[model samples]
Each structure stands twice: as structure tokens, then as C-alpha cells.
Target chain A: MYNDIIIENFSDPQHVGDLESADIELEVGNSVCGDRIRVQILLDDNKISNALFRAWGCATSVATANIFCDSLLNQSLDSVCQRDVEYKQQMLGELSPSQHHCMDILNELHQLLSEQRVAEDVANG
Target chain B: MDRQQLAGYFDYNATTPVSPAVAEAMTATLGQFANASSNHAEAIRNRNAMQQARVSVAEMLGTSADKVFFTSGGSEANNWAIKGRLFNHLNKPGHIITTAIEHPSVLETVRYFEKQFGFKVSYLKPQSNGAISISDFMAALQEDTQLVSMMYANNETGVIQPISEVAKITSARGIKLHVDGVQLVGKRAIDVEACDIDYLSFSAHKFYGPKGVGGLYIKENNSLSPLIHGGGQELGLRSGTENLLAISGLAKAAEEAKCAIAQWDQHAQACKHLMVDLIQQADISVEFNGDTTYANALSNTLNMAIKGVRGEALAVLMDKKHGFIISIGSACSNNKQKTLSAVLLAMGLDEERIQSSIRVSFGQYTTTADIENFVTALNQCVKQLSAMSFAS
Candidate 1:
């Protein structure tokens, strides 16, 4: 049972393609349900510019990947990394009990993105 | 919205739409006020309903009416077949031989017997084509084996088993054979006596009948202990008052199925071939999951793994956007999503292929136009989902 937002995004996902010019390519999956989400982001001056995704799983998870990538466009990398994990969990909007696992996929995608930034910060220092 | 509003529907194995005749029969029986077990003159209507229903069910099963016992549905019929046979022999050491790809009702029942009653079980793994090899079953046969439980056709892949061969062996050796014929009934002809099946299970809903009414056929000499001890209904094999309304519905369905079986088989075969032809003509890359040859499988079911797309996502796009309804695996096994199908997994399918596999089963209601429209919708959905998947 998906909400309107899920049905809308799942029907026609905009950011569902590979970005060849990406600065960071991150992939996360839920081994339980076999949901895989790969995100490719292009960074400009430590800010997100272009974001695209490739996903395989339920409709909710596929839509979540698109929605997550949409939220990252033109935002400073530091701000997203600083965003609370709790806030990131609900950023995908309301999910039913069955669709709740997509939140974990989103969080994992965010965590992978943050881990990449943390590594860059350490290397620069 | 109902299925009539959907763009396409191919999930007949899940449950068929109740036929109009079955509904009318059930409606007519609702006023049978007396209990089926009661012997008063006022009870004759209900009692006659149950008796006539039993006759029809037995005729459908190719058995005498005396051997038919009514239960709630396939699961209960299966439970009664397994536990009814093994419940009394728990203390004794015995062996059970069943396929790894059986419905959960039979699979879990045998597993429980092995763990709770110390009975040894041999789970016969399916061949790569999702078929149980006769040699493997022969190896599992033993002197101490008590019962062999297997399905007549797989619920997911629809691969027909070698029931006659196994029946010959088991009957000669005095071993009881319980066939879960839930999917095979009405779709194919069954002869329990000729096939030497000791216990056979079937459900009404599987054959365009009402739900909650199923029957089991026990051989004349083979007796199973009662699962429910109450007023001795169902020849004292299963207890409690019969659902007279549902029984009348099942009888009407059974009578209709006797004449419609061959016709259904023919129509379903045409639809199945049309689906395959459209997929090939569209240049869709898919691996047929089960045996494609009609000799080894049912003509109605076609399980395929579409390359570069997940089955669940494809099903979702078809259901939501295109209003198509299909299924990935057995509809009853959706409670646990973490695991892939034990049926396909037992057939040595890779996890990725198993995850991408979707089952498209046809029925008497399916038409050539429905198949063409379904393939068109499926093609578009597959292309869209493929673009989003890494496999593309």
C-alpha cells in the first residue's frame, strides 16, 4: 500500500539514470529484500550539482532513491552530512508498514554519501 | 477497483473469480436452516446439500463419494492428510519423502513431523527445470518410510510431478501417498483410484468455486486418524458442522469443471503461447524459469525471469500504472519477504534470477486480447524499469 507520493514518483522517476560525470558514485542495498540503489553525484565547490540513480527493488524503494537524489541537488555537501539521521529517515514522506524498509535504504544511501565526504575532509586536512 | 477495471490480470493461480453459477448455488442454499448432522425431517435440506456436494467432489476427483471428506480448504486438507496419518505414529520411527518445492502447507507439515515426532524426512530437491527426478524419489523410498507427501503441480512454477510413477512404487510397497492436488484440480483430470493415491487434497477456490470449502480423498483401506474430534462430520475424519452454503457452491463448481476442464486447458494454452510469442517478438531477453515444454508442466503457467528488471518492481509498475496484476511467486508465501522462493532456490536458480522471475498464469477467463495487452504493458514496464536497473 503506497501513498500518493510513492505512486507518483514510482510511476515516472526523473533521476533514474547513471551520471557519467559524477564525482562520487555510491551504492547501497538491503540484502534482506534485495533492494539495490546506486547514486551518482557531481559536486561543484563542495555543493551537489548533478545527481542520478539506478535502483532495483519494490516500487517504494525505487521511488525513494529518486526522491533522495532530488533532495541532494545544488545543496552543500556539509549541510546534508550535518543533517540529523532522524530527519533523513522521514524525508521520503509517510510510508506504510510495508514501505518502511525504504527508509533504511535512504538512510544507508545518506550514510554512504556522508562517509565519502568524511574521508575527503580527513584527506584534505 | 476490481479485476474488470485492470488493464490486464494474469494471477489466476492465486484465486479465480467465483463463477456466477457457484454464487447462485451458494445463495440458494443459504436458507437451509437445519444442521447437516441432524437427522430430523427439517434437516434433510442441509444434509442433502452436503451429500450431493460430496458426490460431485468425488466425481471430480475420480473417486467414490464415500471416500471424500470435506475440510475448510487446501491447507486444512493438507494438514489433515499429513498430521492425520502421522499423529498416531509419533512414537514410532518412520520416514517421509516430499519434494523441496511443495506448498508450505506440506513442506512445513513434514518439517514439523521430523522435528516434533522424530520422523526422518528426505526433501527431494528439484532438477534444474523445477521437476522432481524419479531416481531421487526412489532413493528416498525406504523400508521404514510411512508416508510420501508431494503436490500434483507446483503452485509457483506449475511443474507437474511424476505422481503415477511414485504411486506405483509406494502402492506396491504399502507406503501411503498423499498428493496435494490443490493446483491440479479443475485444471486437469484426476483419478485417485487409478493413480493409487491414498490421500488427495484439493480446494474449491482454485477452480472458480467459493473459498473455505475443500475436500480430501482417502483410499478405501487407508484410514487417517481424526484431526478434529467433535460431532462426526466428514465421515469422522474432520469434525464440526459443514458449511452447507459453501458446500453447495463447491458442488456446482465441480460439476461445471468436469465439462470445462479440457476447454480451460485449451484456452490457457493458447494464451500462454501468445504471451511467449509476444515477448519474443518484442525482443525481450528473458529466461524461462520452469520447463517450457507442455509435457512436463501445466499449460496455463509461464514463469519467466526478465533480464535487467526486478519482478516486484515490474509487478508494481504493471499494477499501479497499467492496472495489471501478476505475481512473483506463490501468493501465500508473501508474509516473509526476506527469503526468496524455496521452490526456485531448491531448483538451483541464482538469487538474482529468482528475484527477477515473475509467474504469469492463465485461466478460463483469460483471452488472447488480454494476453496481447498484458504483453504490451509488460514490455513498456520492463523497458522503463530496465533503464533504472543496473543490469540494463
Candidate 2:
């Protein structure tokens, strides 16, 4: 039920594993479906120097996590957090209705990043 | 090598490749285009050929030709047997008993009866070893139970059910018994009379026969309301012009299978042994899904779970990289739902094991070298996937 890009990315996820000194690290999972994703990002001058992810689930979810991490490299944290539904749809081209939830991993990761940034701003103030 | 030829097929339970004899028979029968129901001499020839095929199929089941009724395939046969009987008794409210691991055809048909006709149903769960306990079946029986449907052999785990013993109880209770014999007929010896089965369903493609044709065996003095009500064919039980070519193919395959049953069993058992030896030699941590000893299972089927590897990903890797074809579950069940096999869940397996499990079934054509290659590829794929999972 996956496209060629999803299959290729799932088979060999280019941006996987955790960055030891990541500025922001978060893990999210769906308890009902038993899929888990952990995203780690290292920031340099308000830009993502490197982004990595680890996933455990079906092919679609894992591939989407990989694609999500790959797409965030060298992008500003502001731009990454600003990515909307259309951006996710473009990243995952032509997904089936059932697989649309796979993109939730990315959304959860973004929310966690935004929360982390907000906490850092409050501490600085 | 191309994917088609390079892939070692371990999915015989899904479907078998048509044998040379079956292909030849079908090719020869295709020349005769006359309708079997026509009054012309050519049509009479076709009718006689169909009757001959019927006798061959009946002989394979150790039943009489007159007792057999051809249908589209096992699915239709199952639908017809379950729904036809329930429809026949529409005026009388009754109960039905079936196991949880039945094919969708029987399960859906029974569900339809329950919803549409108000027929109560008792779904019997399998023991941990994937066998339905006779005590459980006995306990589930009720005075109003009109029919009991169970598969002779499970399609996923290949665990053979106690159909004969169940038949004894159901027959004594005057309850009609329907056995989905699709997986059992050609692989093992079946004596419908000895087992006292009231109705049995089997398909041709499961046993090296052509697809699109199968049969249902109904005991004498028992009847079902016709599922299809036109042309009055199949003794007014299944109404359609007979698939003469495929029926001829089915007959030839049945005849060949009956003659080669012993050899086939031996070949399959040898292949299974080879696979087990290879797995052990490779030092792969694995667990067999069901009864691994083959005592109550078909010799050709081996369902197993490799530790720390996702079965779906492993299956894709094996197919795409190494050209080894296996299945995570029944072909019909895959991709339909995100959940694992219902058969495994009913057997009390955990979600991890169910998700990691893959079924590898071989047939007469499967050789020791084929098993060796499949194990080699499996070992490599599992190693890669396990490493990937661990790294993640």
C-alpha cells in the first residue's frame, strides 16, 4: 500500500538514530496502534544542524519519520515548526486514507519542539 | 535471475501452480466449446466429460460422484453450504456453531445469517496449540444448534482440526456438519464417509488444479437451498453452466494428486526438515508459530517468528533483495487490516509474536536446495532487519 519512495526510505532510512548532544529530543507513540517515534535535533545559530529519528511501526510510519527528519536538515527551527498540513501532504505524496495518520509522528515532533522552545524562552526571561 | 523465477515460492497454501497434467487437460478441453447443458451431441460429450471429472473429484475425497456439486471455488462452496442450509431453514430459528479461525467465506456467511436471519452462533476458540478442544466444542453445543462449520486444516498455521471427532458428536446430536476441506483434500487422505461429514468444501487451485472451479460434497438425504437459482445445473443445487475446461483440469490434478499423495507428503516433510536444519545451523533465534512437530499439522507448512524482526519488513526484504517469497499471514488477510492474524490471536499469541510471524509453505516441487536457498536468504534478511531494529 506504499509508494516507491516510501518503500525505498523504509528499507534504508537515511536519517535515523539519536544525536547524543541534541538540543531538542522528544519521543511520541500511539498506544492503541503500537507505533513509536523518537526525534532528535541539534541546532546551530537557530538552524537545525542535524535531525534524526527512530521509529517502530509499520512501513508507512517508519518511512514517514525518516522523510520528516530528512526534510528538516539545515532548515531554521522557525520554518520547521511552521510546516503545516500541506507541507506534510507534499512530503508524503498521495497517501491512502488509512495511512494519513502516519504523518502524525511529524506533527507530534513539531509540537514537542515548539514546547521545548517556549520553555527555553521562559527560562531565558 | 528475474524475480519470478528467482523467488523461491513458500506460499503453497495461498495457491499452487497448475501442474502439467492439469494444464494439458485444460488446454485439450478448451477446444470443446459446446455448452454442457445443450441437447446437441457435442454438448453431450461435454456433459459426459464433466460427469467423469466429478467422479474423479469424488474419488479423491473418497465419496460418491453423485454427492459432489461443483461451484465457482472454495469460497462459493463455503458460502453456498452455510447460507444455503441456513436459508433452507429460514422459517425455523436456530443456532450455529463454528470455530473462530474459519475462512472469511464461512465467517461472513454465518455473520450474515446471524444479522439478517437472527440465527444465533457460538464461535469456538482454539487452544494454545491452535487446535479446538473437543470438550470446548461439546460444551458449546446446544439443542437449537442446527449446524457446525469448521475447517479440516487451518490455512495459516496448517493445524489440522479434529473434524472426524467433531463429526461424531455433531452427527449424534443430529446437527449438520460442514468442513472447509480446501487445505486438507489433496495434501492428505480424506474419507468423507468414514468421517461422516455432512458437507465439505474444496477448491481445485489449492492442489495444482486450475483456478475458478471447485466442488462441495453433500451427504445423501441432506439438501441446501440453492445459492444461485437459474439453469437448474449442479442438480439444482448450484445453477450455472459448468466450467468444463477447469473442471477437466481439476479432475486430472485430482487423479494425479491421489496417485502421488504418499510421495508428496514425503517430499514436503523432507523440505520441512531441511528448513529446520538450516535455521538451527544458522543459529537464528526463532520460534515456530503452531505445532512444529507436524503431528497435527501439514508437513509442507512452517509458520515461525524471527526474534527482533518485523515480519512485514522482513518479507519485503526477502522478496525484493533476495528473491524469496514468503507470507506474513494468509494472503487474504494481509493488508486488509492493520492487526495481526486472527488465527494467532485466537490461539493466545501475543502481539509481538503475531507481528513477527511469517508463514513458509512448500509443495511437491519444492526441493532441498530451494529450502536451503530460502533459509540462507531468510538468515541474511533477518540479520539485517534485526540490526536495523536494534540500531533504531
Candidate 3:
């Protein structure tokens, strides 16, 4: 049944080192099911310019985090603006509801960028 | 190398290959198939065959034919004994006592009774040796305590509990005793009458008979309501069409076991020697989980925890490279949750120890060559994993 995801990612995947260097940090997922991801969003001008993640779990979670980072690099800061739902849709496509169990990693990625935007707006005011 | 790979089976406590003698008897019985419950002359002959089978099982158990009732296997027999006894004693919905390391058939059945019937249960914790003290059981018994169930030998550790001693205590207090004897049935001699046991469960597969057939030894006149209510097959205690062919096979297996117990011990001893040799030669520190000496453990089964290597990784490597089939814990509990075994936790081992524990149990068919191959494979796996962990 799980043959599609039978790959065992024993080696440390890309961007799996430190969130200690990250400004805005988010940890998504749990250890019980053996997957946890830390998304580190480096923001510029209320948009996410760089997204790197450190994940320790099964193959699926590691690959998902790698995909998330691939989607976020060099994107405009306005991509994460709360009113910019169109841009959000453009960056991330539709997925299954249960996929949110894993997609929550992306959700936190978005949420952290939005939080950075809010903090930027407040600091400027 | 793949074709020449040395194969070994260490899960005999789980089941065994059907011996040639048992297969022959089952094949012969299959030719003269008749409905044992029917009233015809051929039916009478079939019924006689079943009775003789029952006598053989009874003789192996040191009990009488009237007390033995067959079921699908050990789990079903356990359900019947535990639930039936509890059902019959609904009025006395008091506490039941059992050990923590019992097979799930006993532990889960008791848990079911506790959940569905409001009955209390005292799961006696085992000492570091993986055997329950009689004093612990005696202390747990109370006025409303209706039953004390303990396994004759643990399925995971093969540590034998003192059922006879526990039976003596329960009988003295006019309480009932149920022994889950799935692992102990062919490994050792059991006498329900001699032990004063009220109920005992056994599975044929564990002793080289066909699967889906086992029997529960209920002392004559013991109060136990039928777990399955239907046409009175096992004296109205259990109801269903009897597996006459399998019963004949079980009887043959039991008879064969009675003659082979002595030979079986020598195999266990040889396996034990291999285990001791492996432990002694290992460079990394390892600890044998339970009391290897004090506990009435089967010499065939050994639970060991390596200091630094992960058991799951090692087991996987052994299977891929060496074709050695083994387990981290009981196959029944190998469900969705990958648990560090509750048996070890109850014995108060640390989490790392529990995580690294691997169970390597043997049967009559296990040979010294298989053990030596396994030891070689295990040493290689452990060394590889230890190096990998360090490099990481």
C-alpha cells in the first residue's frame, strides 16, 4: 500500500542543518509518526525571498520539505501578502484535504511569511 | 551466494512446521471424513476418532478427555476461558489478577472484560527477571477476586511463570486459575489436575500441528458460560461444527510431542549454547533482558539488547543480506504502532534498551548451523550499524 513512499531517506537531506540562523522559525508536524519539519523563512520587504527547511522524518516529509523550498526561492515579497490570494494560489496549487496533514508544513511556511509582513507593517507605523 | 544462503527459523514459540507424522495422520483422517455430530454408523466412527484424538491431547496434558474443549487456536481458546469465566461470574464482578507480560490473547481479553463488564484487573508487574512472584499475586488477591490468570510461558521472552505455585494459592483461597499455555504446551509437561488449574489454553500450530485448531482444558464442573452460544458441540460450553480433521491432527501432534519433549530439550540447549557464545564474543556491551537462570524461560528463546545499534535497522539488514527472519517483538503487536515492547517496560528497562531489544526464539527444527549463520550475520550488521551511527 505504501510502496510509492517506500524510499528510506537515511542520509541527511538538503537544508537540514540549523534554524538557529533563521529570523522567523516554524516547527510543523510531530515526532510520534516520525516526522518533524522546521521552516526558516528569510523575509525581505514583506515578501519571502528565501525559504529553507530542516526536516527529520520519513522519505515523504523530507521530499515534501525539499519541494517546498524549491517553490519558495527568489519569489516576490508580495507573494505572501494576506490579500494576495491569487499569488498564493499561483505559488501553491490545490491538494487533497488529508494532504494538509503534510501540507501543514507549507501552511506554516505561508503563515510565517504573513507574520513577518504583519510585523514589518507594525514596525514601519 | 543467494542460493547458498544459510536459512534459519527462530520463531518456534510462534509456530512450527507440521511434522511428517502429523501430516500423515491428518491425510488418513481426511479419507474417512464423516460428520462427528451425526448419528449414522460412519458418524459414530468419526466421533470415535475425535474421542481418541481428545484422549491423546488429554494424556499429553495429564488431564481427562471430558475437560478438553477445542477452539480455532490459542487466541480463541484464551477468549473462551477468560470471557467465559467472567461471563459466568458476572454476579461476582470483582477483580481479576494477571501478569503484565501475558500474550495479548490473555492481556487484551482481560482488558476487554474490564472495559465491557466493569470488572477490575490487577496486572501484576514482573520483576527484573520477567517472572511474577507468587507473593505479588497473593498480595493482589482480594475477597471479590474471582480469577488469577497467568501464562505458563511468555510468548515474547519464553519466561515460564509458576502456574503450579500460583494455582496452589488460588485454589487454597477457593478462587479460579487460568493458564495461557500456548508456548508451554509442547515445550514442557502440563497437568491441569496436578496443578489445580481451572482453565488452560493451547494451540496446535505451536507444536507442529495445523493452524486454526487448539483446545482449552477446563476442569470438570468448572463454572464457565459458553463464549459462543449455539448447538451444544463441546458439552454446551463451546458451540460450532467441530474441525474433526484438525482435531485428529492436533491429537497426533500432541502424541508426537509427548514422545519428543526429551529430544526438543537438546535442541533448545544447543541453541542456548549458540546464544551464550554470541553474547560472550560480542565486542559492544549487550545485556540479556530477563533473568536467564531464575525464570523458567525456554532455552530456545533469547531476548538481547545491544548497547548502541538500533534493532529495527539490524533486523532489516539481517533479512536483506542473510535471509535471517526475526523480530523486534511479538508479531501480533507489530501493528501500526511500533512500540518499544510493554514487556520490557514492565520489567523497568530504560527506553534505549527497549528500543534496541531483539527477540530470537527457536524451535525443535532450529539447528546449530542456523544459529551460527545468524550470529555471523548479526555481528556484521551490528558492526556496520555502529560504524554508520558514529560517522553520522
Best by TM-score: 1
Summarize candidate 2's per-residue lDDT along A1-125 as a digit string, tens digits.
66887778777878877688998887887654566777888889888889887766666777787887888888987787788888877787777766666666667777888888888888889
Arrange candidates by lDDT, descending.
1, 2, 3
For residues B75-188, write the lDDT of model 2, one tens digit per residue: 999998898788777899698999999999999999999999899999999998889999999999888999999999998889999898999998888889999999988999
Q: What is the lDDT of residue B26 in candidate 3?
A: 91
Best candidate per DockQ, number? Answer: 1
Q: In order, how many clashes per candidate? A: 0, 0, 3
DockQ of 2: 0.27
- Give the per-residue Cα lDDT of candidate 2 at B196: 96
What does candidate 3's lDDT look like per residue over B1-392, in tens digits? 12233255666766788888899999988877677899999899988888899899999999889988989999998888888888877776899998888888889999988998899999999988888988888889888998888988887777888887888888889888889999889987667798999999999999989999999999954588788889888888888877888998899999998899868877787778777787578665678888665237877788888766656555655665567877773111211344568899898887667767788877776767777778887887776555434222
Model 1 residue runs over 4 Å out of place are A31-34, A43-47, A94-101, A118-125, B1-7, B329-337
Model 2 chain A worst lDDT run, 10 consecutive residues: A97-106
DockQ of 1: 0.53
Worst 10 residues of 2 chain B by lDDT: B329-338
Q: After superposition, how far is residue B377 of candidate 2 from its true place, in Å?
A: 2.4
